[model samples]
Target: MRLAFIGLFFLCTTIYAKQPAVTPHGVETPGVQTLPYVIDGNVKVFHLIAEPVEKVIYNGKINLLEEFVKKNNRYSGPTMKLPVEIQKIDGWGYNGNIPGPTIIVNQGDFVRFHVSNHLPEPTTVHWHGMIVPNDQDGTGGTADPVIMPGKTAVYEFQIVNEPGTYMYHSGFNDTKQALKGLDGFLLVLPKDGVDLASSDFAIMLQDWAIPEGSEQIKYLSMDRNWFTYNGLAAPNFPVLVVDEGERVRIRFGNLGLMSHPIHLHGYSFKITGTEGGPIQESAQWPAATVVIAPGETRDIEFIANNPGLWRLHCHVLHHILNDTSYFAQHQKNGIFPEGGLWTYLYVKPAKDQMTRASE
Candidate 1:
């Protein structure tokens, strides 16, 4: 009986080891959605609608003002009153999501986009960091005509560039449209079909200027008070979960006004690629923080060896804090406090480690 049991154990182990690892196809954008596409013979077709969207930046039950006062004992003034409900702000987005949904495709594939405009003004989607025919570049008045309100425009192109991180945003009134959250990521993978990492994540960074008492975002204002990742502020951003010792990749895209120095705690990672494409392995260097400037994209990779919940946030003091202007007002009343572009990386134990521990 003992001999038979030993043989069965070895057979089971062999079968398990032979099973192919399920590879992830596309990158995940936590707190945001991905746009779906349909394959038609030789082309991938995607539809997008430009319209107004109400995004919830802060949905926690805790009142930020009260929490700020508690953390700072110097505040003796009356408590700053705020609504006791979720904070929803209005902005323009693609397909009903702030920052829009990510579009993923393999290199060498033909792509077509059907973009419909529902906004008050005309707009065009310029493919940033992508090399395509000038006529299909989606630059209003130069390469292509803008899509008027209630009208749809078609953009067809081939993925001629190498695998890399790219972006799409409004070409007409670029600054104003992007500031109002009309942008998204476009990830082009290699045709060879090799998975880059075990866990891949995409983060879209944006800054907003919303008046103290209003939910409408000020697209023309130079001052920004709220910073977000995937359209969510700090403490509200979705946590990124991975297994210990797994390879991880994070892609960041910035369409906001200011540059964001994204910092990751507990590990030093290598900057692997950018909007232009992957950097040679020999040229890649280790860094704990990478600065993503306006209209830029960056990709980083690391091994999640340390098993714990680590912080990944922007190093900009005000960018990590919510409603900087509101905090400033409380400071005038002797209450100074902190907290936007932030999330946690939860690395759990590997399956083998967990099994050994249980035994």
Candidate 2:
């Protein structure tokens, strides 16, 4: 008993002795600053600095316009041997993020799009499913002229359709342009406003094929090696976070060659609408899975009642796996990896989880 007590005393002495003598780097002694000292004699100190934030303000006008440049973009992943260059890509969308940005506007606002062609060929931005004037239809050879290389043009149109999900993509070379990862989703809200939901998300799915050790995508190969949501495969994709008991609206769009049967593991949702318009409340239907075909878009809403990590992915087996060769290489050795058209839907306990994280 005495030895044990002596040992406890020594342990306490050692812990206290290891405490770091923290001092403020740019302030007076002990001025509201301290370092965290761990048992292994490690000290962690942090400095406080204020940084400026760039703010974008909107005021119900269609004055907002974005630039889209077509170029080659490099795509890489943990499964690939080297980064593959994707031809017919976007400078703003590919550089900033895949599938471009989420364009949100009121039902009656006038929106304009500034498009610039930088690729070897000509291209145009088609407001897919949008009822624009014939001149602003963006059909390249038909509705409008192609935005040639090093040339820029603008398409301005007023939103006349009902509030719902919509899609935008390259309409120049049809399959060739759209298949090169040139597509995005646009959201139109009711003029008054929408019901305050827990959160909202826009997910765009696409597929790509690139040969091993190659830089450019194989435009003709049907064996696509990479499937992505917003240009990121599983494990690399950001988690879709929401609070338990909160309602969520997920807008889905597919601009690839094939269709995708998207499945959500934990909850069923109502098909709220599509790119055409909002589905009437009486016409809405509940579904645990929905199929999005090429050039299609779907809007789904659900209450996150489950509090856990759930899987959201394409039901197609090959789409859920990264590459065909990778799958074959592993199948021969009995090793199948997880990642591809999959991501986690994280449901937290409370709304504070969202607020605390945003702050």
Residue-wise lDDT of candidate 2 within 1-359, one digit each (tens)? 99999999999999976864321121110001111112222221111111111111111122111111112321233433212222222222321334655556568776656666655677788888788999898898997898787677777778888987787777788676667655666667676664445477777888777555443456678888777776665545566767787777777888877788999988889988887888898999989999999778888888899876677899987887655565565454443444567776777767456442321
TM-score of 1: 0.86
Best by TM-score: 1
Which candidate number would show the highest lDDT if scored against the true structure? 1
Give the CA lDDT, 0 to 100, for residue 7 in model 2.
100
- Estimate, for each residue in 139-201, the C-alpha lDDT of model 1 and write its tens digit: 898878989999999999999988888999988988778788899999988887677587899
lDDT of 1: 0.83
How many steric overlaps does candidate 1 have? 3
Clashing pairs in 2: 85-215
Model 1 / residue 78 / CA error / Å:
14
Q: Which stretches of candidate 1 lie over 4 Å from their true place?
A: 1-22, 62-85, 332-339, 351-359
List runs of model 2 lying over 4 Å from the truth.
1-96, 351-359
Cα displacement (Å) at residue 223, model 1: 1.8
